[model samples]
Target: MSFYHTPKALSAFDAKFEAQKIAFGPISFQVAHCLLKFEVLATIDQAGEQGLSIAQLAQTNVLNEYALGVLLDMGLSMGLVWLNGDAYVLDKTGYFLLHDDMAAINLNFVQDVCYQGLFQLDKALVAGKPSGLAVFGDWQTIYPALKDLPAEAKASWFAFDHYYSDHAFPQILPLVFAHSPKHLVDIGGNTGKWALSCCEFNPEVEVTLMDFPGQLAVAKDNATKHGFAERIHTFATDLLDESRPFVEGADTYWMSQFLDCFSQEQILSILQRTAQAMTPNSQLFIVETFWDRQPSAASAYCVNATSLYFTAMANGNSRMYHSKDLIKLLHQAGLYVDEDTDNLGLGHTLLRCKRKP
Candidate 1:
């Protein structure tokens, strides 16, 4: 929070340069992607201290001198490559773009799932609907349509979704199971990853997954494959359907990387129903990547930019939330944060809530 409150970090000249970067962000993004796709960055990286010239890149890689020249010229401006005596060397930014797992996953997700759709962000904002979803198909939201998405897009989406939470699960298991819950209800349990983890963590805990039928089907299959079929059960329903009551009285309920998919009103409605179902002893844990809670400016930037994916591709009304807003919603729903843990798994925050006594 203090980071945001301080005076501007950049000088006026540097600020103007930064603004230009934003203005040309789309072009820079595609140019960077192209460099990766054509192995231009990789070739330069392999050259080490010697570096590679346009003619050398042309001779070595499939691309001609003209193609390498244009891409590498843009890369120079983008700080992805540095020019030294007519030879191009890979820069730190280029190294990360080529080898960083997080960068690769996010790049794929943006390109395959959200890039084309993002063009319609303005319309989605005005219409209060995922107007950009038309690029894929006619769907109210991206959740149910996940099963039908193109192979690359679906892969990227799931990879991006799981990467953050997967690291947190090991750390969270100890906290969640400290009290020894008998029954754990995984709300918005996509593909039963958490439920499966819970089962493996505690041999005796009964895990029930609650999600859309399509997602539950995949989760059920995974459970069966892992031979945890008996321990992990599925409860399929649309959580946003206010008339439908949630499965009640679980000892612990978990919503991981789930709530951000919804608008504020919908989140409140879901939380209210969840509170209705919780007993006095019941605990609810929410795992999310709250932008305000991020540790660094880079992580914060990533979280903030992800909000547009919701606006254009996911649901059109939800964005990555501030922690304060979520805490307020919990209070409204008769729940209060009993414990808040930050810096878990890729800048995620885990909030443990209990019914207000």
Candidate 2:
């Protein structure tokens, strides 16, 4: 069953409450973030089941009593904390915010990279341009500007981007290496993480990274640092520039969490160019978190919400794709899905495509 189907899980009152939550989401999010940032949640969590009163929590040197009280009051309404008599305790959701790696990474990414820019989302939608990205500078997309982003934003952006793809690497390494590819091309090779992974996976495999010069520079640094300098090569070019064709020698081509950085039309153009450069024996692997294929509603929700980040901050037209839509694009590009594997490391679906016969 599709995970996107509507459900009658909430009552009329519950639905209204949910709507109110959405209405107050921005402020509530800021309040909850402040609670975590000031270590208010940590104090309550450290207090164990005993919890802590506003006065006691303030004594921990985290925040003043007034600040603690106001944030806690909002936190209580937001369900991040609970009131047991006069004491405040962290809720399960709060626990995740404090401890879950994914949650923490996502939180940082949202706050550092997306928060301010997203204020211009309405403008972006109307103009079909990243109006929110004006907070950063005059970049057409976030990718090229990645290197120059403010320190916190750069860190959070990489953490968020790498977390999703890095988790799936170990599982996919065997599958991709099984083909015994002599040369592999890593498209949209951000920071050379996947290229490094391939180098480590196969001692003899030589990998080429295709991306903008700035990104390639970072990737090259990472490659040298990891001692894979000789094996991991760089090809600097703009994929959106249709005049530049794909570098044509690799037996294996890989794009992990990459294609979704483009609109359907752009994706088609990219796939077509790649297809044109491929030999009959070439194999291309596409890894993406297709929202419809998520393992749970929560995962699906996160993926869907991330689509807006693309619209408002990253690029103005791209989004997380449905597997069917991507597959149709692949077919239109003269490629056929030879293997469709899902549920690989954090809901990524790996589509192994080959040139149509």
Candidate 3:
């Protein structure tokens, strides 16, 4: 089931809580986030079973009692905290919200990269462009402007990007190299992390890192520093430009966590061009977080919610896709999924496809 469950029934207290939660969602999020961010949660957790009263926590953190009380009360409703008698204590959800790797990364991404910019999502929807991205810089989209984002924003963006993609690399590397394909083209190979892993995984496999010039610079340096320079090659081109050509002859073309960055029409164009480059024997591998194929409710939540990030900040036209919808794009591109492997390294689905006969 999706994380959003419709209430078949609710008591008056529950209904009232739900209504208030929805009504004050934005400020509630800010309050709960600040509580965790400012170490208020840790303070309460350190107090253990006895818990810490609002005045005690406020004194410890040098925060006002009124502010702390309201935030803590909101956290209680948000499941980030619980009341022990009259005192406040960190709840199980709060512990995870503080310490869980995924939660922390998502939180940082939201606060640093998305929070202020999301104000213009409604405008973005109307214009079919990322209007919210204006908060960061002026550019048609975020990808080309990624290199220019403020330091903290850039860090948060890549951290969010790599967190989801990195976990899948180790699992995907073996599968990609199983065929002993000599030349594997890593489409949108950000920072060459996957290429570095590939070089380490199979020495004989040569890699062509394909992406925009901004990303390729970092990728090339990473490959060089990692001693994969001899085997690693770079292809700098904006795949969005249909006139821009892609190199051919690689037996395998790999797109990892890349396709979701474009609209369906853009995806079709990329795949169509890619299909033309493929020999009858070439295998096209697409690795993406398809919302419908996610392994858990939490993963599905992240995937679906990320669509909004794309909507407001990354690119206004694209989003996380359902597997069936992506498969339709594949067919439109004259390719077919030969194998669809799900549950590969933290909810990623790997589609092993080929040029249609």
Candidate 4:
């Protein structure tokens, strides 16, 4: 009973734990890398119960069997595989990695983008900007390079970006549509992913997506795929510029996974313009990750890394503003915070505001 009160011992334990984590960091990185590379789990899924040998796996995926063996051995150490007499089989944890089940969320996106992006962490820290942008110069400028990426890689990026709303939106829909907005505008709505989700959930709602010309095409394709082409409209515009065309008579203006890609001045300006375009009864909803007054280690890492990534790649950053700071920003634009819902998923929060109604 008294051992718990030993502060010195506890501090020593924490130090040791941190040291261990630092030492084992590369293990974590490699395990994830190997998993994605081998498509071990995915391969198993495709091949069914028939396990593949290292040679078979290598030939099938066009990989070097010797190099893959090293990685697979590492994975076995991490308990992700079972080495059963020369044949490799997916263990319980490894099985999930292959299938697009619950754990699909983890393997698909974060591992592909965030993991790879971390290589430039030092550069991001030094430059005070996202490593992607720092390395690539601009977000739009990098797409041309990615055009030749394999389909799996592209799908991984899409999965990661869509992780914000994939399955978490339904839980927050009640809180989101409590005010029952009719006409909705999604600014910087990439591919209309969120807009489609909102429209699907709220059948009576009409959504207009405003984004760049390149992205509008993707959004249009998404709308068509969702059979909401008639209900969803697309407009191309630069949201940062003063000459941007605005959405009018909208009961709700939604920015999902948006708004973090700017300076405070830019955010205020955008909000002010949005306020001007809204009716007195209109509402604005911003869904984003929030940093607590004293953020946890995981939250801090995610927010800081994401901020750097966006800044470097897209000229954007993630701001984990507190509730009061959010209110202040809204008020600066003549809008007021009406309500907020926390813990949407991970460290995310939703701030629902209106035109000082």
- Per-residue alpha-carbon lDDT of model 3 for 193-311, expressed as tens digits? 88888889887899998888888989888888988899999999988898998989789999988899999999999999999999999999999999988877778978899999999
Give lDDT tens digits, candidate 1, residues 215-307.
899999999999999999999898888887787999999999989999899999999999999999999999999999999989998999999
Ranking by TM-score: 1, 2, 3, 4
Question: Best candidate, lDDT-wise?
Answer: 1
If candidate 1 were superposed on the true structure by all CA atoms, what would the RMSD be?
1.1
Error of 2 at 324 (Å): 1.0
lDDT of 4: 0.69
Better of 3 and 4 by TM-score: 3
Residue-by-residue lDDT tens digits, candidate 2, 80-111: 88989999988888888888999888888999
- Candidate 4 regions with alpha-carbon error over 4 angstroms: 1-14, 35-111, 114-117, 126-150, 293-305, 311-316, 319-324, 345-347
Off by over 4 Å in 2: none
What TM-score does candidate 2 reach? Answer: 0.97
Better of 2 and 4 by TM-score: 2
Off by over 4 Å in 3: 1-19
The Cα local distance difference test for each model comes to 0.91, 0.89, 0.88, 0.69
Between the candidate structures 2 and 3, which one is better when assessed by lDDT? Answer: 2
Candidate 2: deviation at residue 230, Å?
1.6
List the candidates ranked by lDDT, beginning with the highest: 1, 2, 3, 4
Each candidate's TM vs. the true structure?
A: 0.98, 0.97, 0.94, 0.72
